[model samples]
Target: MNRTYLTNIDTSISDVDFTQHKNAVFILHDQLNLDTWPSWIREEKPLLIFIESAAKGKTLPYHKKKLVYLLSSMRHFAIECAEAGFPVYYHSTKQHYDRALKDILSQYEDLHFTFMTPSEWDSRERLRTVISEFSTKVEEIPNNFFLADAEEYKERVKDGWLMEYFYREMRRKTGYLMDGEQPEGGEWNYDEQNREKLPKDHSVPSIAETETDEITREVIEMVEKWYSGHFGESEDFTYAVTRRQALYRLNEFIDERLDEFGPYEDAMAQGKYDLFHSQLSVYLNNGLILPKEACDKAEEAYKNGNARLNSVEGFIRQIIGWREYIRVYYEAMMPEVREANHFDFTNKIPEMYWSGETKMNCMSECLKPVIEQGYSHHIPRLMVLSNFSNLTETDPRELNRWFHLAYVDAYEWVVLPNVLGMSTFADGGVLASKPYVSSGNYINKMSDYCKHCDYKISKKTGEDACPFNYLYWNFIDKQRETFSKNGRANFMVNMFDKKSNEDKKAIFESSADFLEEISRYKKEQ
Candidate 1:
């Protein structure tokens, strides 16, 4: 007789079972690779389960495209596992995770379960609850998906926790572009070379599009019916759903797009959605393309003389440096980090975020791509969307929620720090050295948005002026005490202090009128 002992760890409970099968493993959504499967479990060739549960779908109401992509990809992965001779169980049901685990456990008596640690806190805590309900022992294996481990980050981030130092350490550790303890070009960052605006009449590179198969089509329909009121479009889904397709897209990016990606990574244009970006964040976040794979591919392009050193270095830095750092930062600061609202902004989110019914061409332009495909590059997220939110004093938590719901690449681990820390400065100065607010001049200099907008970027006051101008000033004045102490932003505060009393008064009045109008925008939207 096989014996299974269930521990009453928390409120969650599991029924007793007696079965001969000894082990099984569960793969969470973010941990989709076979490499993450534990070695001890590999010896057993345990039953692999991927549950499609209601816990995710009903939690915060995700985008339709995001939902479809995950479900379709999981289904496709299950098929691949079966073909590879793994005993795979794909459960698609409308229930919580514990119920799905219960159903799986009921299939074989006395079967011990195992899972790779999740990439997120909420999911990890949820897993603990679910495992407590099972009579069999559940094993947790370490997640090795990231290039930098937690100890590496903790070791380096002791003094001030700056990203540049952490990033340089990763370069030294990975040896991606190391030249005898120095970076490839004797500089740690090629960001200066990567800021050139898109030249007029230059053609943007076209992105690789994946053909939707039967599985994707089925997912599309399922999202349409089940998630009717979700924030995204389900039709004409084009994301690569399998690891093979993701790898192919990664190669195509290296061969065709990597060279130009560096020079124009920060540029945003009138109708150009993706100028030279690989657009592989969704695949990277979903585990179809690992961070190591992306970094190696870009480095390969430079070694083979297909891409310039600046382009290759810039691209690789994003994956290994920024992407890896953000994940580590999210892990280090959580639970409390999620609710960090340093500015104490309480204003409701403007209706324009959802409807895109604004005269600001910059905001409208950014929203167009986001609404259509559930995607956009980093500049827009920082400059247009988050920049606007920061200047207006919109609730950081509110903006964070919108980001979590809107983007396909948004997992809590990625989205929370990028928003609370980097994007909105919601964590005060924890993630960013200074706030990232900018006037219309930065937008006009960076893109052609001002030339086509209704308001004049030159004007700093009144309704005909660019909203970013006064809004930018208003934020500086409003958060003067908070910002005046930081060296990176103190200069801007000095500039604001030097302005004449009349000019400052007019700027505040105009901002007040605009904000009042914004308060009424809910009815318009």
Candidate 2:
């Protein structure tokens, strides 16, 4: 079945004049909503351009659900724009941005394009060059979608590159929890109290899921038919795709999940899937909800004494601090950051990563969520998926690619710094001070998944021993000289140095055996 699903609406190019259609507003799939539209954007009443770019689809063979989410959301937004008295030119084709824009320019003469600057470096650069060729005025608006603007980030980051420092700067700049010159609660960080594992009796709040309307159903069918072999499941596509739904989810998160969001923010458990983590990254990454708005809401809750300061501070840090910091980092070091592989790891990704078939319960559990829903909170991403990749010396590029393909919210700028820098330490401490490596003990402490696992968390060696235990030592030994330079990693390196040479040898052997077994499994698959 070689069929293509392209969105074609009524519009003609024959003898088109620029007098009537000179002004055009091009919207990317990620920039689905018009909430941040400038007065000029609304005043000009430009043609709303919604492109279902096939170049985007071919970029990574993204998950079917992700495809459905973006396309459905775009379709919905187009309908809204039409209802709002804007001429909507919706088109889908098997062409990249450059080609698509060229086609559009050909159809409509003397046209000027107004677009919110693309979030990705490549797209932004390409669009700039494309519009330059026409010699027409291209109004590239500043993206006010984020809380911290580019100028603000540049000024604050002049002091330091550390995330905590940047976070504090953001806190002060935003006045999120400032009492004049002091932080609220007299503490900069509340992560100390936010590390508890879930109590057995604790219950998770229900997710405020968006109902799939008719347009979304069409997209699902389109993706299921066209992207049949893409990464994730498409059947249960229930993500918030509009502004109304995203706001509802945000409010629900504050009312029900924000209190418990601080404590147990890092905790992972079996069948607890998302636990108390607010799954707004999907909405936030897209244009549905702005960071400042979300952070302001959390702060408002704390001011009203509705939520605790710890929870409020922690939640604000995620939105205004870490999320914004990563974007700044991505802009500072890209093109090079994309190719950064400090360890020069060349190992192939195991077949199990895609299949979600593994003996290790931690990896299995983590990968299963990604496979089923294209989501898993930050813990599993850093502690489990990237930890395993770092320990096994899996290629950072491969890990990064998998992340972009597998997750719904993944954009280039967001995914690169996280995967290449924080996750793999591939930039040699540009984004992370030290590698986020942990043994079975950390995973066991955080979750009950280890309790029912095939491997024993207590064991240090042998087939029954958890792979993470030996793999952690193997990575430390392998990168001993490199990691020994970092102050934070020195303690772990010193502990590994004190271990008996015999135990060290056994750890290396087990790691080797496991890697060989994984290779065999790869061949079998």
Question: Which candidate number has the best lDDT?
Answer: 2
RMSD of 2: 3.0
Q: How much lDDT does candidate 1 score?
A: 0.81
Q: What lDDT would each prediction earn against the true structure?
A: 0.81, 0.82
TM-score of each predicted structure versus truth: 0.93, 0.94
User: Which candidate comes out best when scored by TM-score?
Assistant: 2
lDDT string, candidate 1, 452-472, tens digits: 899999999987999999999
Q: How does candidate 2 score on lDDT?
A: 0.82
Report the lDDT tens digits of candidate 2 across residue range 87-189.
Answer: 7777777777767877778766778788888889878887787768765656777775776676656544433478898888888888999999899889998
What's the C-alpha lDDT at position 259 in model 2? 85
